[model samples]
Target: MGKSATAATLALAAARTGRSVLLVEVAGRSATAPMFGAEPPGYEEREVYDDADGGSVRCRSITPDDALVEWLSTHGFRRIVRRMARSGLLEVIATATPGVKDLLVLGRIKALEADDDADLIIVDAPAAGHALGFLRAPVGVRDTARTGVLNRQAREVLEMLGDPGRCRVMLVSIPEETPVNELVETSFAVEDEIGLALGPVVINGIVPPLEGLDEPLPSGPPPGVSDVELTEMGAAARLRRERVALQGEQLDRLAERLPLQQLRLPQVFGTTLGPDELRTLSDALLEGVGSLEAWA
Candidate 1:
């Protein structure tokens, strides 16, 4: 973990377009702030959003419940649910079933970017496993709710998801066996089931091979090492390189299904970057693409 990282790359990339971005994360353990050098107090949108290169990116986090309830209220949901929370029932209201949580998380992302003031909404979403569940949410809720406010919003979200111009789902994964397998499934699920438009894949923590060493290098360590220490010395680095290979293979498979735009970033440094790293990320993503493209 000696190199600079780009955990908030997507968020910074989206915000660089002069759009008001709603960078959302599902995990209770916050991971996004250090990429930007500071955390907001709970949910407040701090004005001076600085990146590693000393630039600015605005971000906000909303709980899954808040996202849904706010979207409903904004799009005209009945007050019973929104009001009950006001009457001192956060524990009661926020603790809905898992499906309900998924519904709200997506609804918030969809609704927040509707206003003229807002431009982009980058979701850190859940990590590999739950992240797929988060994408499956619209269809899942639509089928189960059947009728009423839940069903209606489910329909709206799903419709938006299907339109390639409105929503784009992207995957972030390290090049490793388990995550690569999960991403393959995610690609299939988004197309066949949830019916979402997908964009390029971001391959995080890619280990760089020595540049310009064209011929395939020898597999073993330097000539002067004992076998035991050689095994230990090479283990971690070997695994890291193996993951980079795994990512390349996964991207090739994913490309057969769709246009796979890939961004490869090295492992993060022990001491995180401030505005400087954010700028590097923003520049990297914008090097080829224009907008974040909510849709394909």
Candidate 2:
């Protein structure tokens, strides 16, 4: 679905507004760093892009194990953090408890939010199913802990997740049947179940409609083009036309079902997704942002 690329583009878009942006990946995949032409960043945030107008983008990756160790160390359990890690107790605990790992990661993000480290933070969350679990972790912990530091931390994380002014989920999806269906379902789950506010949906990988796709192929091959080559070209053109029509249908259906504004990103071809690609997508993202009433 190009979520990582979209996150990087969004970081660039936000940075262009003279706001510092932090791009965070919770799944431990340092996908954003590569797009910025940088090496993978670990737990420490590293500057990826610097805007001329005093804004910039930084990126970091957070894993559940690392978060848990840090959480324990900061919460007065520092003495046991090493032991727990060395003995693999941390993994056991995280696996046994359904949402503990997610809660730890969210807690760290909550702390970052509280510290005012960046003007805007874009989290490259996991896929739809895990994202739901990730958002719901704080709630589960808050309920289970009830009256301790853990509960307090969970409550604070929930506050961050639920507050629209502080945070909002931007869902990314390709224009297709199953993905669109999942996006709609996830939006509802986030709103109805988690009560988290949503930002504009990003529709990635839109293939621009070619002007002459509907016209018939030439009756005969041109110079240097064989009949077989022409036939293949016609077939490819037909596929493109069908794909464009299908994407249009899905986009319309998405608007009717989701009702939120969408930011459409053109399908990038042939490029290896480096700084140049980020700039192109960022420009497109900013244009889409400009059209939204809230952003304007």
lDDT of 1 at 137: 75
Models, CA RMSD each: 5.7, 1.7
How well is each residue in 1-296 modelled by candidate 2, as lDDT tens digits? 88899999999889888999999999878888988888999999999888899999999999988888888788798998899889999899777656778988998888888889899988999988788988998888888877987788888888888888999999999999999999999999999989999989999999999888788888999999999999999999999999999999999999999989999999999658998888999888888888887831
Q: Which residue pairs clash in candidate 2?
A: none
Instruction: In angstroms, give how far residue 3 of model 1 lies from its true place.
Output: 17
Sliding window of 10 residues with minimal summed lDDT for model 1: 1-10
How far residue 239's Cα lies from its native spot in candidate 2, in Å, is 1.3
Query: What local lDDT score does residue 55 receive in model 2, on the 0 to 100 scale?
Result: 94
Clash tally for model 1: 12
Cα error of candidate 1 at position 31, Å: 1.8
Q: For candidate 2, give the lDDT of residue 241.
A: 92
Q: On residues 145-172, what C-alpha lDDT tens digit does candidate 1 reach at each position?
A: 7898788877887777788777777776
TM, every model: 0.71, 0.95
- As a TM-score, model 1 comes out at 0.71
